[model samples]
Target chain A: MDNSVLLKVNQLKKTFIKKSGTVFNRKKTEVYAVNNVNFEIKKGEILGIIGESGCGKTTTARMVMRLMEESSGEILFEGNNLCTIKNAETNRLRKNMQMIFQDPYDTLNPGMRIVDILMEPLNAHEKNLPSNEKLKRVIEAIESIELKPAEDYLYRYPHQLSGGQRQRIAIARAVILKPSFIAADEPTSMLDVSVRAGILNLLLDLRKKMGLTMLFITHDLSTASYMCDRIAVMYQGRIVEIGPTKKIIQSPSHPYTIALVSVVKDLNYFIENREKLILDGEVDSTRKDTGCTFVTRCPHQEKVCHSKAPEIEALGNGHAVACHCHSNWLEKTS
Target chain B: MSTVLSIENLSTFFKTDKGIVRAVEDVTFSLEEGEMLGLIGESGCGKTTVAQSILRLIEYPGKVVSGKVILNGKDLLKATDDELYSLRWKEISVIPQSAMNALNPVYTVGDQIIEAILLHEKVSKSEAVKRTKTLLELVGIDGERQKSFPHEFSGGMKQRVAIAMALACNPKLVISDESTTGLDVLTQAQVIALIKNLQKKMNLSVILISHDLPMVTAICEKIAIMYAGKLVEWATTEEILNNPKHPYSKALLNATPNLSDPDREVVSIPGSVPNLVNIPKCCRFHTRCPYAFDRCLNESPELREVTPGHYTACFLEGDKNG
Candidate 1:
């Protein structure tokens, strides 16, 4: 295992047996929510997994966090295969891995006081910490998130706080364990735009202070660009493109990646080409795809693209794309 | 340049247990024939309330306390229930925020649109059905799927069906309040493109209300920025995007992460929007403004013209020197 790599996911796949039609006529069909996904996060680097809804970004994060069982493939954390780990060991390992969910309103228990919520993790891990020590740690965590004065918010329930404040408390809870890795799944998507920046900035500040590695998942391209050091663009459960943030934004290779980037509502470019929609067609995950997953929507697709899946081809400077027509596109555009 | 809709001194209030919540206060703007105006704001900044107030959709405990909503030379605020009912689908219509609940799940999409057409027009059922098919096709939905229930259609398709229903009567103006809020990026693009094309073909005036800044800037000809229930800035889309005048507008533009400039530091406005039950006596945004001084906290600023076709309500704009 490379010490620089904090976590690595290899060929991770997950499928669900969805049933349709009523009663006796029900039909069971397999939908691969996540298939053959691969990525890695370096120590203290933020790796963003971005795609449209149901594109497997969330499933990938859940699988890595051991929240959902992966059907096959390897999730290596600190050189350990987390998939085959026993329950007792997994629970112990969870102290270093935490997840922040999208909706703060639903993530935290509404009935519990903020202090108790923060204390639960500490008690579970430490087992015999004194009450005053726990209280000091909770206060320290709340103050770190800037939920000012600590005492005022310590006794309040989640409902008593606004959406922004609730999200701040959520962040505070996630970091209370001093986790080495955090999976923030659209932490700011449910927030108001004005307050969204504040949360994002807080996350960045926490990253610097704690030296944490993150797997930030989101559907919004602009937000992904802002929060991520590198981004992996997923389509139909597979990573179609992965690259540095600047390269992904400036010179996206895959047609699916291009479509995702173009759809970004940039005030400058959108004003210039408002009428041009790069791609269409919704993602149909139930389809048993043999060829490239993005063939149906790829504008530059060829005969080979419909017959066989393309391997991820590398293009220097830490950029890679899984598209057969990448070279052809390069020739045409350049 | 005929004005299709004009709102003057609109102040809407909600009688909550906490106190009288001024959801919208002294909001004013206008839309010309065949123009698209975007109302952009945060969640509780009263963008939706302004749209609801235009059609008098406020229910008990909520009232348009004072204002004039003039639509096509007539004041809609003063129009009676019967007159407003007849005027609704025929002259103005709305595509509500959530397409899933905006449409009745039990009724076929075709039947719903046809029913709306029949209620506002003197057309036979057959004629209404025919118009319904045309309207469905206009929004890119197949006429063959007209019999499908809302559940059968995808979220984007349901939104398109909602659009078809809104345009069934060829209303002169359409108000779409967060119409594409929950749709995915591709679906959002397709729906917005469909609306833009339809608006051009029919020469329909549109008011699009959303908190998504990029989506709003992409399509709207003129843009209005609302903060704490007040229209803080109004300008042509280019002017506002390029040279925003008000401090709140400037913060909003900066807060949005630009695809072109990913490395730029995004500084969020410090405090959340103030509760309207006990709004401050001065500028509503003064609590969060970085440049706010004693004057901003003591005296309220009115909307004043800062440049050609640009208006801002900030004491900083009035001060030539810091």
Candidate 2:
């Protein structure tokens, strides 16, 4: 409902029906991939969804991109409820939203040239544009992604380009339409640190130039902290903590957030005598749980955390956390 | 500490359809007893190739042209097939990059690790099984879970199994080539911490080949920075952190986003990693090196000891030191 909000997700849930046991003994179970996930990305703002594998970060992102249909709940983009919208209007919505996937090697068609890869979106969305005009725009898009001259890369196949180059072309493909929003799901995770930095900086630069709002999803906290204006830590399809990037990293409230932040190895000088919670095991999304999703792995879990789900409580300055034992951290943090 | 393993003038080339691909050329580094050496480079920079060349794992198309992989004063490269076979797993074993593909699907995780131990050492099935349980427990996995198949374990658990398998024979030297890769960040850190802890506990020499510079620098005592098939810099972690000699090393450090220093500018190195196919002898990093000079383009820089222990292969070492 907010004028500044570019995209808002309300209780967006996605579940997969998983069946276990043999022919004689069979049982079907509903795996909550994305359960009651809610967040909003303001115009020109980047909100990162940080979580480990199987934490539903990618699933939530796919629902926003409309690549995957949500089981229930609303995806509101610019005052429009995308879920309720007809199929005809959804096609038009595709023009404004695009997603950059994890693997660059698989995203692009190896057989297709860079020119054609950039043109496919345009062909689908803007069919009225003349052939030459489309070609010029493809070149412009290539140049915009900083693959200089554009001609050098336009004719080359995806196989010919390096991983970073392919990812840039992927970014080029995403932004060629000049979409208002981009859901980048671990775009640089596959890249080397050197090239990873280039991709991250390029995304940051593009955000400024294009005035783009991004729902950046990553498992790496350092990367999330760098790319996101606000960070949302996800565990088992639920947001454990959502706050300013600095607040999440420096003074994290949730135990999972603390663990995530502490685990990110950096060249920067280590914080002296910091309480590093090296929690064993990972957050499994499937087994079915009624309480807080992170209860299984939370180092500071209480009796209430196992029986009752904690509601998202505002901690001021747009920061919020869903943890029964958040007060323990708050006391220390204060 | 004594030098556990030393690679002298190692060169591995792949006879590709295009030409002779210089995958790892003149890469030299020594790992001391209980020392953790981080072999870092971009993809195709031949970090993995160097690891492969060490264990004589280079297959048909790729050949270790010339190198001396001296382990325990014996050149592994010159070792006969029988000798090399005997040495592998018993003295030195590799923890491959992908744990998913590393384990045999048909075998139980315990059976796989037990097989490795029994094959290397003169141990009975019962003895091997007991050791396997201990190994599994050592890597922070429950011993009972060893009976589970690879598919039964999660991505992180499978990787831990791989680590347990790698350590089964109690190899004096372990080559954990990107072991933490494909796992989540928290798991990656935990696995890395496990490796570091194991190295100290067992007094094992480790060669951790990866592309993650920050993670490498954080745990690895020494670092060998590679680029386009050449070892650009080899130094202590502190030296690499505070005073990196090679332009590639400095660029890598700069390019990495430091979590502690959030406001620090993350400047990416220009240009992609150079193609090694039919490449001439020159600084492999010249194309991406900002301080590249005429000499960098014309000739290859040999690894020189600029300081007591720090080594670098760059024309602009003087500039770096100054």
Candidate 3:
């Protein structure tokens, strides 16, 4: 493990068991939502985890934040195993690591004032601080997010503000603790395009200003490329590819990564000319241990792809891809 | 080219305590046969209202104030209930946003399609079921799944069924309102491809309303950019993407994150969308637009053709045409 790594996740696995059959006789089946995932986030780096819905991107983030208990794995934060920490110690660890959720409307309490929402985390973590100090901190946090005239927004309810404003309030609340790490899961997916850029830029500015390391999760590849330093492409509970943002965008190694990059519509003329590899079929979340989760739709799938699971192969330059046809892609492109 | 649908100065307002909420105001555009037009805007920009108004779906406090919706050379607003009923599904249909809730859970997927076919056309149960199976196959769904309930189908499959239901009567025009907003990227691409393939096969005109500029650019040939209840810019997809005329349109382009071009700077508009009730008499986007001038403060700009094919509603471009 790298010494500069702020968060390290090793062989993370989460499974849900469901009982089937009549009330008289019950049977159980295990649903592996996330299976043996490994990745690391260095200090001050924005590591993006991207996948389709039900692909365990959100589950991975939740496990990393310790919001959900993992079935098996090790989550190391600053040389300490977070999964083994006591309740009190875990609560303290939360002060250094925070999470920003997907939907701003649901994440925020409609009846609470913006100040109250921002102060909840502060009050919980910084209980020793006086009332005046808490108020000052809330005001400062609101100002940092560029909410403007913090006094006016302090008394306003979440419904009174626009979607973008409410999302900013959410970010302000997350950063008030000055956490060393943040996990934002689909933060801007619900926002309008005009305001989404503002939120993305805000996150980037805050990362630079506070030196915060972040795990940004999203399905939109373009956004991940814009904000993240490196990206780990997840598909069906596995990291299919991981590399620097530039390398991943320029030369995507994995077939799934290629499909994702090809789908990003843009103004570039070359993209219009290039042939699109639209992946057919749907993501099956309920399937039992299948060789190559993407085999059902891979355009270049071989007989071996369906019979054997490929291991993560290092392609050099901090890039690693998990695929059986990676050699074919290298040979064809190079 | 013959025009399939023509909207002239269409305005819709909702009577609210705040005031008359002008959701869609003085919006005019024409859709030709076999053409796909993308309506792009924020949530409250009235893109959905424009689509619903064409189908006369505006109800209660929300009413269409003025303007004519001429579909197939007939005035939809002045048409009687019987006349409108004959036109719907056969002439134009709608695929709404929520596929999960749009379908009836209690009824099997086949029964719903049969009901739709029976509503517009006098068809027997057996014949309607046969047509329903064919429609399902056209949209890339197994005909065998027609017996299954909506809850049994996956999200992507449900969306395909919705598309199938919309095309049961072979409508010439289809209006899809953010149909793929909640789906995953891969599913979104599949749904889009399905729509495009159907459009080509049937030579249908489609009105795709969504806030996602990238998705819109991928499918639609022409695009109309809306802001604050008004259409600010209208042009072919290429023209709109390559050279946006309005500040709002340019800002939207800059705001979108493009993987193909990583070096482009992201320019986010300053403020949020303004309240639609009692909108400003001047330019609606003046509050957030960076190019607002003295004229933009006092007088509203009409949608004027700035180029041979591109149109924009901005004081900055007003002088260029003159």
Candidate 4:
């Protein structure tokens, strides 16, 4: 109920049923894609969700954007529940929440010109505006993304642009409506390293210019640390750790978070002597275990980690972790 | 150390309708025994093209124009079809970029690796099957899971499987062309560590082609930086990291965000890569080079050694070295 909060997701859960076996004999099972996830984004803050593939980061973002319906929990956007909003109300809120997807190749329509793509969002949201006024706003959006002289790019198709340019057009489409909250799912992962910095700097510039709030989702810890004000590390559909970006990178508490932090390759001399705590196997989302989700791959897993589920324990200053052996590990280390 | 592969004045050109695209031009480097080299560049900078040209895998429109690719004292460029075929898996193999679809879906992972071993070596089916098991285990995959199809393994595991297949024939040189591109960061580190340990243990020379600066510097002993179909700098990891000669190399290091030093600015190099079709005989990176002079605009600089083991192809090197 904080006034400064822009988007709040409370105990969000999404599950899918998987069926197998022969045609005559069918078996069903539940797969928890996003289970009991909680996070909050302030008016102009960026919260990043970091996790490996199939760890429900995308699912959580989709449910928050109302692109995917959640099986349980509430997604409150400025104190309004997006899950239960009526069509008219949802249509109105649509202009305020936009999503930038991962792939630039698939997101934009190759056949359509850049002008039409930028105008689609405005046409849906501001139907009563004059054609000239809409065209002016579209040109402004194109320029805002730093694709200047918008006329040069307005008529060109998506295929005509480079990967970086195409992504700029995609970003232009997202910001054309001047959305306050944007959920960018791996926006720069598809981009090359040299071009990636430009996109990241552009987003940061847009945030300063428009005071935009972002839910940046990426599997790269360095990018998450750079862009996010706060970070949430998810595993097996649950957030294992969440804290301020500095705290998460410097003093991560959870075992899974520690393993993830240790594996991040930086430019500082190859972490050769760094802890080699390599987690085995990928996230198995199909497991219906009642214990901690990361128990299978955790290096410091104890008996308690298998018998009981770990709850989020606050260590201080908005820093929290869900791990059974954290206290003992801290004591042993200290 | 003995040299495993030496590429001398290698140039590969693609004949496009617009004009002849000089993808790789007069690139020269050598890989020593048990050494790992990282070829770093932007997307269209001919990093992959260099690998393809070395392996003699350049397709129809693309041809290796000139130079000698000497592998273990044998010239791959002058080799016949039969000689190249025998040299491919026995001496050189590639871990392709897309591990997800690099494999055949119908064949089991074990059978595919076994097929690779059986085709080049004169081994029986049973021996090949046994070798496949050990190869799978070498990359950290369970030997039993090799029976599963490509779809059954995860992305990282599939990449590991590809690595096992690459080493199936005991190739002397392995080209990992963006092998860890699509995997997660944690998984990428794991796969990279696997490759590193294997290279050291087996004494295998590797050519890692990637755009990831941090990773390329972290593992690879030597670094070769490419900029638009031309190598701008080649040096040891320490030399490249401590004192980069080329402006393109410095710009690349600046562009990559350092996780350890989060406060450093990540500036992107301005201007896109120039179109390669019928490119002028000047420096390809002159358009984006901050200190590009009139000479750089008119004439291309050759890769000349400034220090003992460091090579750079920038006109500014003359002013700075002296």
Candidate 5:
């Protein structure tokens, strides 16, 4: 147990039972949404989990937040296995862990006022606080999110506020508890680009001010490059590559990571060479159990990739890639 | 290069109960033949309304109050409903914003495109189907699966289908409004590349309306930044990226996450978009402008040429090159 580590996720796995076909011809299959995932976050670090849609990034985030139970794994928080904890203990532990969802409109209650929304966590966790003190805490939370003259927005409903404002209120609600760890799942995906920067800046500011460790999940590589200290690229319920953000962006080792980095719309680069480094086919999440999960669409897949899954091989300085053909592909490209 | 479309002082407003919402105000720009222009703006910034105004797509309470939308030497605004109807698919077509809900799920993808072809061109059913297959192939979709319903296809495939449908009648100009809004990175890249390749092969004029700045700048030769129903800046892609004169354009480019400038901190413009119904008499962005002075608060700036092939609407740049 590393004392500096805030949260450790070891061999996290989740299986979903998906049913299809009519009642007369029913069929069921097991889908591994998060399979054998492992990662660690130190205090005050921002670890980004990025992937295409249905690539298990959100699933991994959910399992870490304990919003969804893992099928079998260990989520060690501060040297305690969260899964083995009792219900009452887990509720207390949740005070240090918070999550912000993708859609701010859906996450915040439309009927409640912004003040009430921000105060729910305080009321639940700090029940013994006096009314005046609670209201003071509420105002502090609202002010922390930079909604000027906190009184102006305290009584307004979610519908009355814009998308960015609602997201701020949601962040206020999450950080109202002063959580040490936060899992933000596509927090800015629904926002307009201009408004999205505000939320990202707010998150970064709060992380600096409060010493919060963030698991920022997004589908945009450019954003991940901007906000993350390190990035873990997920594909079909598995992290194919994990490394420092610059390393992943500059020298992506995995085939999927390379494809993702190449697809980023860079104006200067695209004009000089309009050639697309594209990979065909959508991500197939139904794992066959024996082969590499990315083999279905991997551009550099070979005979070895079809029979055995490649283990994560370290390449020094906290960069690792899980692919058998990485060395061969690197040799060819270089 | 000859001009394919010219818009002069285009102003579209909605007479809502709250008041008259000036959605698109005094907007003017021109598109060259076989050129690609990107109209980039935030939501409610009136980029979509401008596109609607060009095609007379606004209805009832919302109307294009005054403008000259000249298409192939004819002012589209002056044309009758019948004339506009005929001109829509024949001269200009649109790939609408959302691929998820824009498509009709009941109709087969092939039939919809074929219907589009049959409506405009004097072609037989078999001939329309043949052309539809070619359009499908042009967008990189397999022509055989054109018979599948919209629900059966993935998000990217549906977007390709939309592109195919937009090109059914070989319209000289295509207006793709946020076509890649909700797609994944790879899908968005594929769609953008497809549009670029199609533009080259067909020599078609394109007006790409989107909030994705990087995607727009990557493909479009010219970029227009819209804020609160006004064209704040317009320039060649290179000039716009390198030397953005308008404060709003500069802030937008700064706010955007660029791969090349990885270490830059994205500074968000303070304040939300102003209410369109009661836009201030002065500059619309004056409230959020960090460098705003008393003059900016009292007067609005006009879009003036700052350099060759670059224009900006800002008081800070002064009248040096105007």
Candidate 6:
């Protein structure tokens, strides 16, 4: 309902049915990849979704992008529920929303030139534009990504470019449509460490220059904290915590979020000297219908956490946490 | 203060049709007993090549042309093939990068570890199996799952198994080449913790080769920054992270995304790493370095000790410290 909200996801759910048993007797098991997720991205804001692999962060982003059909829920994009849109309408809506995938190597067509990659989005979305206008737009897009001497890169193939250059091309393709909202899923994870900062800075710069709203999904908390204004911590198909980046890092409310933050290797020596709270045990993705996904590894889990799921409780400053022992944790820490 | 491994002016080159690819050039560093040294560099910077050369894993046209790899007291290069084979896994072993794929998928996790132990030591099959279970438990994997295939376990679990296999022969030195590259943050932290714990418990010396600076800082006591096969800088992790002196080292630290300092500006080092075959005659980094001057173009800087503990190869330090 807020005017500032650019995109709102309401109770989104997705499930995959897998066939089991022999050919004679078929049985099915539902894999709930994402379930009952809710969040919102403000206009021109970078909302980060942080989670481990198979935690439904990618699934959530895909569902919002409408790349995959959701089982149930509303994906409201600028007052329009994207889920209600028809096939023809969805094509038009895609112009305003785009996604940049994790692997740059797989995302771009190997045989295609950098110009063609950027032009594909424009040709599909802006079919009405003239040939000369399209060429101009393509050049503009290349320059927008700060790939100077755009002419040199325009005709070059993906292989001719470096990892950082290819990613910049991918970004150029995503923004060539002039999308108001974009979902970038681990864009810099595949890049070398020396080139990662350039990509991150380019994204931040592009966000301001284009006035774009972004949903940045990454498993690295440090990267999320650096780029995002707000973050939602997801675990096993559910969002366990949602708050401002500073709050999530400094005063994480959810036990899982706290564990995630604590595990990040800090660059500062003083912080490195402090004791680390090691979260023993691995993340079990196959566990079925558990009360709380994090209860298995939670340090302060109570008996109630094993049987009853905790509701998201308001923790002030637009922050929320879902944990049964949050109050007890607060008291103990204070 | 005893040195566990000392590499002196080590240079490894790969002969290709195009030219001689200088993979590791004049790289020198020493690792103390029970110390964890982090070798941080980009993909083509020859960090892994240095690690491989230590274990004599470089095959075919690639050769370690010069320098001595002195482990404990013996020169590893001069040791006989039979002696080298015996010394490997017994005294020094490696946990390679992408250990998940490095593991034998056909063999069960338990069998592979047991095979490693049996090959190194004149132990019975049953005794080797027992040691495998203990090693698995040590790395925090379920000993019962040893019967399962590599595919049956997750990525993190597979890496743990690899670590177990590396430690099967009770080797004193473990060279881990990008051990935690593909793992998620939590798993990476867990693996690093496991390595640190094991290092302290066994008094093991580790050569952790990775491009991930943060991960390196977490586990390593000393850090080495390499660029185009050259040792650009070497110092304590604290010194390297907090007071990087070399231009390449400073640029690398600046490029890393620091979450704690969100307001700081991010500046990337321009241009890619030099082509190995046509590497610059002087400073390889002179092409991309912002501080490069005419003097840097004519002569290569030697790896000099700028301070008591820290060493950097940069002509600019001479003006400031002189």
TM-score of each candidate's B chain against the true B chain:
0.97, 0.97, 0.98, 0.98, 0.97, 0.97
What does candidate 1's lDDT look like per residue over A123-168, in tens digits?
9987788999889989999999988899999999998899999999
**TM-scores vs. true structure, each candidate:** 0.96, 0.95, 0.95, 0.96, 0.96, 0.96
For model 1 the interface RMSD, in Å, equals 2.7
Off by over 4 Å in 4: A265-276, B319-322
Candidate 1 on B1-322: residue-level lDDT in tens?
A: 8999999989999998888998999898999999999999999899999999999999889999998999999999999999999889889999989898999888899889988988889999999888888888888778978899999888998999999999988899999999998998777877887888888899999999999898888788999999989999999999998999899989999899888788898888888788899676789998899888999888878887777678788888866533
Off by over 4 Å in 3: A265-279, A329-334, B122-125
In candidate 6, which residue pairs clash?
A: none
lDDT of 2 by residue, A1-334 (tens): 7799999999989999988899999988889888888889899999999887888999998888778899999999988899999888988988999989899999999888888899999999999999999999999999888889889988999988888999999999999899999999999988878888889999999999999999998887778878889999888888889998988888788877776676664422222212246457455657666678876666666788778888888999989999887887557646
lDDT of 3 by residue, A1-334 (tens): 6789999999999998877799989978877789889888999999999998888999999998888999999999998899999988988899999999999999999989988999899889999999999999999999998888999999999999888899999999899999999999999988988889899999999999999999999998999999999999998988999999998988888888877777774323223423335444666666677688888767777888887778888888889999998887568756
Task: Candidate 2: list runs displaced more than 4 Å.
Answer: A265-278, A329-334, B318-322
Per model, kept true contacts as a fraction are 0.64, 0.69, 0.68, 0.64, 0.65, 0.64
Listed per model in order, the count of residue pairs whose N, CA or C atoms clash below 3 Å is 0, 0, 0, 0, 0, 0
Candidate 6: lDDT of B70?
Answer: 98
Tens-digit lDDT track for model 4 on A1-334? 9899999999999999999899999999899999888889999999999998889999999988888899999999989999888879987998999999999999999889998898899889999999999999999998898888889998999999988888999999999889999999999988888788999999999999999999999998888887889999998899999999999999989877776776664422223523435456567778875889988777677899888888888889889999988888777756
Considering the two chains of model 3, state its CAPRI-style docking category. medium
Clashing pairs in 1: none
Chain B TM-score (model 4 vs. true structure):
0.98
| Predicted candidate 5 versus true structure: per-residue lDDT over B59-90, tens digit per residue | 98999999899999999999998898899888
For residue A64, model 4's alpha carbon misses the true position, in angstroms, by: 1.3
What would the per-residue lDDT of candidate 3 be over residues B14-124, giving only the tens digit for each residue?
999889999999998989999999999988899999988999999989999999999988999999999988999999998989898999999999999999999889889
